[model samples]
Target: MAVSPAAAADTDRAGTGDQRPRSRRSGRRRTALAFWAFTGPFLAGLAVFTVVPVAWSAYLSFFDATNTVTPLSEDFVGFGNYTRMLQDQAFLDSLVTFSVFAAFIVPLTFACSLGLALLLDRVRFARAFFRSVFFLPFACSYVVASLVWKMSIFNGVRYGLANAVLDLFGVDDVAWLFNPDPPWYWLVIVSLRLWIQCGFYMILFIAALQQIPAHLYEAAYVDGAKPGRQTFWHITLPQLRATSVAVVMLILIAAYQAFDEFVNLIGNQAYARPPLVYLYYTALGTQQDLGRGSAGALILALIIAIVTLLQGRLLGFGNKEGR
Candidate 1:
């Protein structure tokens, strides 16, 4: 339709204004799509694999769903599993064993890793070589390492490496894994854990150690703080405090979850079973009780959470510096 010049100009301007908003809307839509494209897969997998499983486990803990074919047919038992767990003597004993192992391994690994890191940090000759050497054991599979400790080192025979070393000292072969008098199985268990994990923690500490400011050490030296234990105490340790806290937390969590080594080395024996091992036996080993297993798992999780919170409170984790 042929219109006046002024009307045509106004019409053109109105059309341009509408087009601007449409273009902006299209741009925003594309941005939203791109965001989903990048993050959708990961979020979906997390929900399906982790979130769903945890939620289902929580739900399962309240039911008597053991040996059932389907959830619909399962019986609901409210707090029955929790009450039963308290009365299970073997379960209680497993907690005690876990506690003792934690007491030994946590401190031992922390000290050994820190010491190795301190030494390695100062090494100028073949620094990478030394790091790789120590870290090599960590790269090996836990099952493999456990097997090596069980069969090769502490075989409880005259030909075992441990016995060979003892022979050098004129000591007879000892049944390290079987002897219950002093609980010598601990030697095999503890050494295997330390050897496999110490290097990884050493790497962590080494990285933390490297991040410390050289000027701090220099200032310490200038203040008549000689290169001694005092410098390490005042400067190095203070700088590595955060890393140390994290390492200790990891050690505690790992200790509580100690199952692979215990199972591989000692089987399902009462002497070395941790909470997870005991739960495993309860759930699938002969009993086939998934409900009780889930309950025990949740309990263990609670223990871990409480211990973590206590450690965090004591160490002031997540606190801002100076606060």
Candidate 2:
């Protein structure tokens, strides 16, 4: 039997209401899919370019591979490369050099940066100008800084600014770079690193210092706390805990990777070189041993990872206690 006109209109309206929800659901799904489709290429490129290459390098570290026309043709040597690295005296020496460098640089950088940040935090006039001046060294290329230090500052003779000033004081010219003595060369390298990095960490500390509530300092003052005592026991040190942890880790990592300055300033002809420079000289200059180079790189990577993990754990523990 044919439906009445009123009944047919009710059925059409019900059907339209049900279909509307389905259409809206489909539109939402399509929009989400389109968003992913747009982002998929970038994600894929990062995995391909960065992640895959690092994985491949780890794989290559186990093999006796050279930079050849065909890398795949290289022989697999298991832990042979690693074993050789363990016995290498030059590798041992480099490890010691890098360790000493880290020991000196990390603490010195933190102390200097913290001091500068505190001083700058109190400054009222031309704060921006002072900050820019301090951070200017970080803006210069490492190679450029190295060259400038080599030629102008540490030039051994009276031609160098340092020696000229010393000469005026009746002091002799110093062998800043070429010295194979106990601490002079190492001191110079450490000083250069401190100068370059202190500015960057100072900026970071300034930012962290800014995040701290001014009311806290005011409260301390209201409580009859002196500036030096309050900063030591309450304000400066506690607020800087997290920033200190980060700066320590960064300085440690950079100290281990000290290469550009050492290479440019002292060159391969130096009596002492850092681990990275030593590895480069071994792989390309003297030994032509890609396997050993890969092994050294892997070892350095492991050391960095272990140190970072330990620092993170310690920092996490401290944060929990602070909370």
Candidate 3:
């Protein structure tokens, strides 16, 4: 028997409904495949270069994976490597030095960078030129910069630029690199760091400063807010708080990871080495003990993680909308 027109229409509607879901599923599958196709190589590279090494390092930390011709032939020592750190006086001293270094450099960089950003924000002339001039140092290699500081600017001789300036004040040339009595080395290290890194953070702050709404400043001005410190405190700082948090965190991480310059300047000297430099010397330095090196790295990672978490908690780092 022939189906009625209404029944035929219902049948066609049922077919169309079934086909819609199937088509949707097929489209979703294609999109997923395309995503994987594009991202697969990057994910593979990340796994090989980053994720695998990190995991292997953690594994090695628990073992006596040192002094063996073959890494795989190493025996397990459990937490022996970790406990070694307690007895390692030089490593302990390095941690102290790094903490002192971070304490000084982080705040100084933040303040100087923010100050530069503020100054540049107000400059109607030569703004870009000044920004480039400041930031150009950041592009220079840290090793080269440190060497310049050691060889040219802060050279222990009387002809060094810093020593010449001191001479103008009748002070004798100071051994900035080798003098550990009053820790004159810190001046070289800290000044070099400020000159190289402050510009990068300044650029970040500048970007954040530019992002602040102009209308808010205009509104503040109409309400008798001056363009000086008043406007800066009320309008600029609060707006830059998030960027400031990020800059501070970056500075902390970078400070903790310091090695190249320290090694290049301090060499094999036992004085004023940071944790990373210490770790390098421990693992590969005359002894070649990979186990202890790996262990120190993991411990440093833990310390950094703890400190970062504490900072995020204290500063409410990730909170965007007010609670």
Highest TM-score: which candidate? Answer: 3
Using lDDT as the yardstick, the better of models 2 and 3 is 3
Residue 28 displacement (Å), model 1: 4.6
Where is the poorest 10-residue window by lDDT in model 1? 1-10
TM-score of each: 0.87, 0.82, 0.88
The digit string of per-residue lDDT tens for model 2 on 1-323 reads 14443454455555555567677555555555655577668768988997786676667767776663124644788898898888988787877877777778888899999889989998999999999999988888788878878899887888898899989999988988887774577766777887888999999999999988888878888998887865566877887777777788777777777899889888874366777997797667756667668778788789888978887897763463245
Reference-based lDDT, each prediction: 0.85, 0.78, 0.84
Q: Candidate 1, clashing residue pairs?
A: none
Model 3, 1-323: lDDT tens digits are 14443454455555556567777555555655655677678789989998888788878777777664236634877888899976788888888988999998999999999998888888999988999999999999889998899899989999999999999999988998897988888888888899999999999999998898899999998999898889888788888888888899999888988887788888757788898888888778577788888889888889889999999999888777223
Off by over 4 Å in 1: 1-34, 69-74, 320-323
